[model samples]
Target: MSVPLFDAATPRAPLREGLRSAIDRVLESERFVLGPEVASFERELAAYCGASQAVGVANGTDAITITLRAMGAGPGDEVIVPSFTFYASVEAIVHTGATPVFCDIDADTYCITPETVRAALTPRTKAVIAVHLFGNVAPVGEIQALGVPVLEDAAQAMGSRSAAGRPGSLGVAATFSFYPSKNLACFGDGGAIVTNDDAIAEEARILRFHGSRDKIDYEQVGYNSRLDELQAAILRVQLPHLDQWSDGRMQAARNYEEAGLAELASLPKPVAGASPAWHLYVVSHPDVKRLEGALAAAQVGYKPYYRTPVHRQAPMLEWGAGVDLPATEHAARTHLAIPMSPGLTRAQADEVVAAARAAS
Candidate 1:
């Protein structure tokens, strides 16, 4: 039997009854964009994350850019970002016209540490983006002590929490993506910015709709990045199930641990006080290529979250010149994401572990 990397269908099938009705309701109302459903979902999401406000947007990338812009990040400013994260994190920084200063990630957590952020800081540093990579929270409390605004990129960490707080409530502002594959997924692209600061929330709302506070007036130049009503409704349907899905993913991670896969590779290490969402079950080995080949032969799906560190990407090389990120480079070369999702069966996880052992 072929085991795919993610079985979105299995988990989604259970929600089909409610999803069909939700879609029908939207179609009957004929309200497709920025409608009541979007507002309702935003409220529900904010309440879930323990935030005071939430504003829905087009995608996760836009959430970061809009939040940065609202926080006064622009040209002549610098934003510290993790070199090991998805390229979209850096891209959002660039969109705000602020330089992205690359920082190395912690070898154990695979997320940036406060020490790395401090080393990357410059007088021009205006803000920091703390990415909750692979569903594990970054050290928000330590980074916040640096006295600059911190934006939590919780795109992969919907149900995660740290001792500091839930992902959305930890930073000055946080971003979430419901990109069909996240812990709390929608039917299509959707995102939101959650914050406790009233000023930031108000600005994000204006900025997401072409800088318009009202239909006839434009406050500042902004982009069209509103989350559509359909996606919002779909997200609402899935919101209540997020914790259950997260628990299932956590169980899968435990299954991997119990399978003794650690003999072949290193497993993910959650932060001491963190309750991770376990978005991906990633393992690392010096010989990742061999492990991948074995999984392929066994018809078990596997892939690397990031094979190339953002700093090593061609477009980012110039920005990363003279910067050294040993930990990021090592993680990029070694980490491999095996089949991991609430839908993954224990038998399937065992199959993946068996393949890894054979390769080792």
Candidate 2:
């Protein structure tokens, strides 16, 4: 009974029938590029996020890169990003020729804090990327008030809610990923950018398709980033089940929370007004090495969300003088992501909770 950190195969299995049918339809139709399926899914996803428009792209990294480029961020400008997120976040900023100002994350939520953003701000800072880390929305509203355009990195938070009780509508643009491990995953890589701004939306749409406004008329020097028709069809099939899947993940998290492992392991608490999508069930402990070993012995799985913060990585974008991020550094060292997916059975969750309690 070896539990991997994530088993995307289980959740994708239920959609096999629909996926097969959709694939066959795509093959028969022969309209494999950005067509009806892609457009329809974009519309549906926009509505789901309470945004006026959504534009699909090749993958999550492309989604961020194109969105930033479409928003007019380039070479000399600076974009503030979370130091605790995946490499792709900063990579996207660098791909645009824009510099990324890395800011530390909150101790609890592991998302960039407004204070950190304020400290990192400069005259060249044009935008802030608020990453909804681990399915919990960050304090985007506060970051917005800083007089800079905000980009919501909702990659792990497709169905997440903000502290204001808003559902994925806090920035000039919001991006979502449909990687295999995401709660609302596609069979392969897929991503979208959601926004209420019509101009931004239109720009992103055009930019995604080689900068073509009409047919072969290149408006700007954009790359090929269109979302494939097949991926869109898969997303259309999975969209309806996202909230239901998120609910199940939340229930599993509640089981761990109620287990009172906080007494021994440092458990994460949900923000005051957030309805997190519970993408990953993370817990921190100073003795993470010992605890993770115990879980491995019990046949449960765990892994650190980030072993090293972004600023410490080799790809050093021209960020300003680095400041000590003690909390972020500690979290990078101590945090562990437990087995958490909608497909995780109650028995499995109980087993994980029991293992955690014993390790504690």
Best by lDDT: 1
For 133-243, candidate 1 gives per-residue lDDT tens digits of 999999898888988779999999999888878999998999998888888888789899999999999999999989998868998899899999999989899889888
- The pairs that clash in candidate 1 are none
What's the lDDT for all of these models?
A: 0.90, 0.83
Model 2: per-residue lDDT, tens digit, 1-360? 466677767766788898899888888889988999998999999888888889988888999999999899999999999888888998999999999888888888888778989998999998999888888888888888888889988888877776564445788888888887887777789999999898988888888877888766788888788888999988898899888788877877776666655676777666557788788888898889988988988889898878877888766634524657777898999999988877677677667777876666
For candidate 1, the per-residue lDDT at 351 reads: 87
Query: TM-score of the candidate numbered 2?
Result: 0.95
Instruction: Write down the TM-score of every candidate.
Output: 0.98, 0.95
